[model samples]
Target: MERGDFTDLPGLGKPLEDLGPAEQGHDPDWWLKRLVEREKITVLPPALQLRRDDAALDDHLDRLGGEAEVRRELTEFNDRVRRVLYSTHGGPPVTTPPRDVEEEVRRWRARREERRARRTAALAAREPEAPPPSRRGRWWPFGRTGAAGPSDG
Candidate 1:
C-alpha cells in the first residue's frame, strides 16, 4: 500500500525532540498552548487581546513618529476596548479600561523629553572634534619658496 511519497520527508527516521518535562497532569492542553506560543500565534479572544495590547500600549506609543499618530493609536485602542465591553460574545471579562488621551499625550511628551536629554548627555560625553587647519599659513615639506631641486639657481 506504500509508495516513496514519505521517504524524502525531513526527520523521517529521527526521534522527536522533547520540549521539557510535560505539565500534562496540571494542564491537559499544555502541548496545544506550547504549539501556539512556539508558532507566535495570536488567537486570544477580543477582551484578552485588548488586555494584552493595554499592557504594551506605552511601548506601542513610543514607536509612533508624532503626537497625532499617538492620539490616533490611543483612540483606536479605546474604541476596540469599548466594542469588546459592549459585546455579549463571551470570553474573559473586559477589565482593561480605556486610556485617557490627554494623560497619555503628556506621558508620551515627558518620555520623549527624557530620551532627548539622555541622547544629548551621551553626545556631550564624547571628545570634541578637532578644528580644521587654516589656509593662509599652509605647511610645505621643503620650504615656503619651492622644492630644493638641482635646477634652482
Candidate 2:
C-alpha cells in the first residue's frame, strides 16, 4: 500500500513499515522490565564511618556479652546505621554519642593496625627462603646475581 493509503484499511491508520525502532524492536516484557527497574532504583551505600559504626557497635555489644541492655542498644544502633545510610548528604553528622566516639574510633584503628602489623610479621617469619640468585629454577632463570657463567672462570 502507499504511504498515505490508510483509507483502504479499516481500523488503524498507520502502515506496519511506518513504526519506529522502539515500537518495532522490543516486546512488551522488555519495556515493562525497563519501567520496573527504573521504578525500583537502588539507594546509594552509607558512608564509611556509618558502616564502620555498624560493625563497631556489633563488637561493643558482643563485648557487652549478652547484657540485658545489649538487645536494646543493638536495635537502636541498627536504626542509627540505617538513618546514616539513607540520610541525605551535606547535612549534619548522624551520631552524637555522650562518650568520645572519635577516641573510640582511633583506638579501633590502632588495634586494627597493630593486628595487621603482627600478621605481616608472622607472614614474614613464616616465608620460605628463596634460593640464591646464582641458582636458577625451571620457572625463573634471570636473577640479581651476576651474568658471568662458569665458562668465564
Q: Against the unseen true structure, what C-alpha lDDT does each candidate score? A: 0.86, 0.57
State in Å the error of residue 70, model 2.
27
Question: Which candidate ranks first by lDDT, i.e. highest?
Answer: 1
Worst 10-residue stretch by lDDT in candidate 2? Answer: 96-105
What's the TM-score of every candidate structure?
0.62, 0.28
Q: Give the candidate number with the greatest TM-score.
A: 1
Compared with the true structure, what per-residue lDDT tens digits does model 1 show for residues 9-101?
999877555444445335557689888879998788998899889999999899999999999999999999999999999888999999999
lDDT assessment of candidate 1: 0.86
Off by over 4 Å in 1: 1-39, 131-153
